[model samples]
Target: MASKERKTPLIRVKNLYKVFGPNAGKVLQQVKEGKSKDDILAETGHTVGLSDINMDIYPGEIFVVMGLSGSGKSTLIRHFNRLIDPTAGVIEVEGSDVMSFDDKALQQFRRHKMSMVFQRFGLMPHRSVLDNIGYGLQIQGVAKQEREKLARYWLETVGLDGYDKHFPANLSGGQQQRVGLARALCTDADILLMDEAFSALDPLIRSEMQDQLIELQEKLHKTIVFITHDLDEALRLGDRIAILRDGVLVQQGEPVDILLHPADDYVEAFVKDVNRARALTVETVMKPQVCRISAETIGEALAEMRKSKDDYGYYINEDGYQGVITQETLEGVEQSEYDKAIDPSLLDSVPAVHTDALLEAVIPETLDSEHPLPVINADGDVEGRLSRSTLAEVLSDQAGSEEDDEKVKKLKTSKSLAA
Candidate 1:
């Protein structure tokens, strides 16, 4: 994804630090003075849950906070809605300080502005799927008829229309999570906070739920704060990912950025086992080597290819890439009339892939053909070329070099220094 139009953050967490023990707030000074989570714990018996955590969650984006067990991923998410109060920090939603809200204001905020989906599905076993989905609306004191109608609409939205009367116990894990998701949506809140929402499902069911959230995001554009430990899940769902270790933010960035340029050894280790084939796209390794030949004749096309030092070139009109003219095609038309229009029949078939296509998908095409696969964008325009060599390099475990790591470290250092 190229740079999009900048939008102000819908939620901001500033200097957020959470300490979980009796004397939690008392350790603020030690925690802020560059003390490690373990050090703070050993000295004060207060476990550092989050340390100097800051984030600007933009609207209509899935911002993922992920870490291993006890990394405070869940702890950090809870502070967003004041489910757990920070030891010392600020949480703001739409310019309103979360900590400043009174009991009534907080209740109203939770009901109207945000909804949560939990790891356990958090459904009432006694209630029907329809009742479970509408539970948030029921809490809001909405009329029974209207809440049921809204719940039914979301029931169908999450692909569980006929099973409305069924209880949570009757459904599979995937279906139950869909009910949780539909429950969150029924509130019509601007923000959705999902804390390990799909972590309980089987591999296939997990993947299915991930796909569902992505599809729903495309249409609804809710400001989502998703928590997950699975790298694949985070990469697939998060617009941006923040990696945590022992409650400290190790790195935060786009999936490609994190994969190609990890911030630290901790982050590096976490991502080393990630499946790059599925994570990387053709655009990442593609070169801008499309030799455009606007020629009237085969001679002109041959001249263009010679000048570019390429064995083949594509005939491009305003419409887009037409066809390939290889050296073989040129030799066959060497004696043709120099001024005659190039015969389309003589052109060689060129393999092509979309820019967003994964490297794994394009690797087969590269293996099958000798020519570079033209990378086409959404507008049917040739953006670049994906060669076999480039694909090989990307697939290699050492896809990034030591020099690349250095550059990334310097970049992160500079950012930290500036901050």
Candidate 2:
């Protein structure tokens, strides 16, 4: 018989609980025995830091925990590397239960398998930038010369080249954050826990740091759990966002899906002000259909568009489909005394996007460009035209569909009970 395959999560938290109070231990004992939330609350009068939290973080995924203050986002992330002990739960990393590890084992796990960056730049005040970055390696007993070399490499990675001799006090907020990031990454830790690493920076520096994180993630692909209170920051950087409210996981998914179809009123309120049109893209809205164009008269082009019931007409060329002329283009057209500069290359103005790109990623270019963008296949062939209204309608319909589904589910449950 083939052995049963066990799919191990990179990081797993099962029935995690953390309570803060004099009777916290007793309350957590009740929680472990599967007591009701109210019973556990009443028994210990303990504040639940994290309540029965369950999550599986995949390898190489940027998993973000988002919540307001005191929502347990930081508490949950800390439980992963055992920076803070959970009152009740099994925390697993690489198929090993970290919560079960002895002090020596836990220390080795943190030193080798994980690294953390905090909101405050935790660099040593007396140490040089290089020493601060390599501090983790030094703790692990790496040779001084080797640790220095690794620190230099990390400084370059974080775009802090030629600042190896400077102390933490000499750096700006952004530079300090970069040093913090470099220090965390210098360990080459398989798992990274970042607790609001950019929260202390100015708005401009925060945005810049976010961009740097994106760039670094692309290159390193380390499994990361980032905690942040800013939804926009979560949306900008997370591969998947886990939203928390009052120590409960409200919802979790990709940014576009969450924005377009929130799970409840809480989520909707969070996303209400977002520009759906700008957040969604041509690829998200475009229908997959055979789009054809004629190499004949403008009348033939118009006829083809009318026949296809398409808003735009694709212009075919010997090389391939060259450009698209929409009704808007034709409406904007004017006759000129001088022969219009009809560069055949005008067709290239149409922006093309891959199917995998999030609608939000494609919107800014389309909205800012002179011409409408075409949805393209992997081969760069025109798939469909994406207009502003089309993208807007898609978002509206998606939101409506989610609401409709919820109503349908409720009705079914009510009917079942009535019967």
Candidate 3:
């Protein structure tokens, strides 16, 4: 894992606000004075687009802003590239204060350093795909030949190699969005601002586009500010997610961390239905030094695992850890030839997860499957096994912890009432 100190933040937003009203200044004054939420809402009738927001976006990180329609996710994203100027507070991009830049400076900043992709595929109907992708480079006075070369490279990069001559109007919705992505990427800007960029596509195409974007980001390592209302998309794409509610930043962290330890009721509700186990892996939840096993007889394996009193057993291969066969699996199976005929490819099951996955993710896979799964490290060595009982223990602990917290809260409330 990379050390946090080694990663420099590429963008920073501090105490940002964007209230829209004639008396926005006075409204902000009231907000800063620590008025109650209802009082502030009643006084100016000013919608707080963003309130006292503070965050750091690391270089090469796909930082996602997620929320509902009026959550200020869009407004917050706009502030990064200066699409919408903040009413008060500071926004720094690449160590420069964006709010202080003059019109010419800001224009130059956007043209050279930043690019945006909108939910609607913004493309010219009459212009060819090449023209649209090359538009930014052309505006910056690059030679037509040079820009066209760059555009062609991006078109190919975005999987639209032969569609350069086609007009946007002729393209499908997904294809048009690809053109938009290519256009944003063609500028070779250091920062990419995507505002619900894949929302318009059908679910299948949207997933395809997400995969494409992940592949591209892995290769390019561009710093991206992605905005979306879809929690699943945010969780899937974001290295770190910032959840906004009524313009206030509710929570921010890696997806697993956020899901496992939501900071508020709102965030908990947002991720309540998410299949966390799939998102997490065995590596995150496995206990250390658990019993090890070989891909031999089930009776022998069950006896050894039971001796260790562990829920799961790790199967070792000539190379390293191969798979896991648990007691649950052994108990559930009836003596059959099919069990003996288990494919040798079973040894090649999906690689085990590191100890970093959230319980929400690790639990489901263990429960859903008939066999215990191996938890592997980055080097493909089997670290341990994660099984159904382990998952149950995690869920039970979570529930117990919540109950304890509630008791603590109630105790505090009662004490305060007596005082």
Candidate 4:
């Protein structure tokens, strides 16, 4: 993670507001007074496109803006490129105010500083694959040979090799979108603005495109502002997500944080259907475990267990977590053998889960094992232990919270009726 103080933000939007229709500025007072979107529209004949939206986008992060239709997700991304003017507030890119830019400066910014990939795969039907990919560079006045060279490289990078001579009309929807991605990438801009880039594709193809984008991001690390209406897509791709509702900023945070702690009922409703078992990692539910050494005798291991008050403990070595040791093994050993190293054959063969492993994967391993599941880091060192009880407890807490929220709502309604 980049230090906030040391690293400057790539993009910053503050108290941004956009309203459509004439005299849109006149509706600001109504918005400040907490009037609803529908009320403002009925009285003022203006539609609120965005409301007091503020967020900082860090470099090399995929920042996702998502909402249902008319939620202003598409409207919000347009502010980044100054494609749509905000009725109020600040939009700064790299410390410069984008709203203050002259036409010439704005043109330069769009041409060189950033690129957009539209949902429609905005490729000219008359242009060949190579021509479409090289279009951006050509517009920048690069020589024909040089532009084609860069275009061909990105074409192969996007897995569209040997299709350079083909036209957009000849390609499938997925392939056409790849051309659009290649074109934007060909510009080599520091920032990318993707507006529902994969929403038009079929389910399987959309998933494949998402994987491709993730793979490309690992290598390129460009700062991206992706717009989407799909919750699954946002969770899969967003480094940080900002959800909008009726032009208002609802919540914004890492996917895991948003999943674990929704800010309000609206945000909770959005995440309620998510597969928590598959979404949460082992680290979320793991507990600290008492560790024992492989060379230790049964008596020594038993002593450690008694001290920790744990029924069993894990045997660890320099290489990594070995297996589980039980109280029975410690007690069954002969008096003479009690001081010897615990037998490896008698080890419980506990299954280990990586820190990044989802709880869904941990379920089967823990169901049959008597000992707590060992959670290991990438390097195979045991970090903590997870048990079925702990898993159930975390899940129950989530369900209980929802139930509690319903109770609160009912109480509020009852009080209102009494009053």
Writing each residue's lDDT as its tens digit, candidate 2 over 97-208 gives 8977999998899999999999998889999999999999999999999999999999998899999999999999899989999999999999989999999999999999
Better-scoring candidate (TM-score), 2 or 3: 3
Of models 2 and 4, which has the larger lDDT? 4
* Candidate lDDT values, in order: 0.84, 0.75, 0.77, 0.84
Off by over 4 Å in 2: 1-8, 29-43, 277-286, 289-321, 324-372, 377-385, 394-419
Q: What lDDT score is found at residue 293 in candidate 2?
A: 67
For candidate 2, give the lDDT: 0.75
Q: Write the per-residue lDDT of candidate 1 for residues 1-419, one digit (tens) a residue.
A: 22345588899989999888887767888888889888887888888888999889888889999999999999999999989998898899999999999999999999999999999999999999999999999999999999999999999999998999999999999999999999999999999999999999999999989989988988998989999999889888888999999988889988878888899998888888876768877777788866788787767877787788677876776667877778767766646466677777867677779988887666656655667878888898888998756655555555555234443333333322223
223 in model 1: Cα distance from truth in Å?
Answer: 1.7
For model 2, give the 10-residue run with minimal summed lDDT. 410-419
* Order of the predicted models by TM-score, top scorer first: 1, 4, 3, 2
| Top-scoring candidate (TM-score) | 1
**What are the runs in model 4 whose C-alpha is more than 4 Å off?**
1-8, 284-303, 331-339, 394-419
Q: Write the per-residue lDDT of candidate 3 for residues 1-419, one digit (tens) a residue.
A: 21234376889888887787788888888777766456677877777788899999988889899999989999998888788888899999888999889999998998999999999988889899999999999989999999999999999998999999999988999999999999999998999999999999999999999999999998898989999999889878888899998888989987767877899999989988766544554554575646687646656666677787777666675677656556676666565532363234433353465555655544445445555566666676766666555555444324344224443334334322223
TM-scores for every candidate against the unseen true structure: 0.88, 0.75, 0.77, 0.87
After superposing candidate 3 on the true structure, give the runs of residues whose Cα lies further than 4 Å from its correct spot: 1-6, 36-41, 283-318, 322-373, 382-385, 393-419
What would the per-residue lDDT of candidate 4 be over residues 60-178, giving only the tens digit for each residue? 88989998999999999998999899999999999999999999999999999999999999999999999999999998999999999999999999999999999999999999999
Clashing pairs in 2: 279-360, 280-359, 281-359
